[model samples]
Target: MADIDMAELGPDRTLLLVDDDAPFVARLARAMEKRGFLPETAESVAAGKAVASSRPPAYAVVDLRLEDGNGLEVVEALRASRPACRIVVLTGYGAIATAVAAVKFGATDYLSKPADANDITNALLSRGEAPPPPENPMSADRVRWEHIQRVYELCDRNVSETARRLSMHRRTLQRILAKRSPK
Candidate 1:
């Protein structure tokens, strides 16, 4: 992770990280703490909202999907409690519509998973400037795979429904889902 300057750490360095993935959230919280943040973590929308309401952090990293509900609800709660909070929306299912919605909910940035600690930190600390292009952008094939996987998930992993929605052959969709994601 890139070292963040102390001056840029803001007046309050408390950070809330909300993700259903327990291991990911724990790892990220540890990483952020190493960078001088006082990190709090939640694994569900309800918990996240409760934490936000109780004490809105100075910054937050929220997943778009949670086991209990949409992470956007948590975002909204945080924004309502603390308008100045810098929130970054992170998700595995990245799409333009969701990204726009995240911004509309007062998120400072939207990042697709699996974003590293460095990327999250940069987004959190950015001063409204457009971020530089990704050092290693996803390939077209990877993007397609991600989209298909997202659709498959949305369809409750039904092969036929996912294929029909994507206009792809059922067998082809099955093969893609069976294989590991491309780099």
Candidate 2:
């Protein structure tokens, strides 16, 4: 990612990056530092909260899932500690439901996994009214898949339980889950 001008970020350039993926976080932290941000890192919800307790960073990038708990916990903590702080929720399992939930939980924006440093930086800086909606949103199949996966997580990945809840045959549900997410 190209290094953004520090002047554009203003004095609020401190960032708290909360993600369990060590390699990805390391790369992002280094990239952000080069872009002139004072970056702090936390690998779990607990650590992120601790960092916020001292003082919320001017911005935060929190992964949607962590070893300890949901990354929304970190977002809420930052919002509570400093409402002015900018927050972006990063998730591999992107879905309309989760994206809406992230924003409802105080995330300024939500980005899918594999987001570049520049992508995150841009999202964190964007403010005010939202852009026009996508002309073509996700397909029904994709939305159903996302909802099934979310329910599977809620059931602690119990295939039978999720199948029961969704009124799906066990093998059918398993097959749906096994397939890669539809575009």
Give the per-residue lDDT of model 1 (tens digit) for 1-183.
Answer: 687887899779999999999999999999999999999999999999999999999999999999899999999999999999999999998889999999999899999998999999999999899999998999999999889988998999899999999999999988899999999
Q: Note the Cα lDDT for every prediction shown.
A: 0.95, 0.89
- Once fitted onto the true fold, the runs of candidate 2 whose alpha carbons sit more than 4 angstroms away are 129-183
Model 2 weakest 10-residue run by lDDT: 127-136
Q: Look at candidate 1 and tell me the lDDT of residue 54.
A: 98
Please give the distance, in angstroms, between residue 150's alpha carbon in candidate 1 and its true position after superposition: 2.3
Which 10 residues in a row give candidate 1 its minimum summed lDDT? 1-10
Tens digit of per-residue lDDT, candidate 2, span 15-62: 999999899999999988887889999999999999988978999999
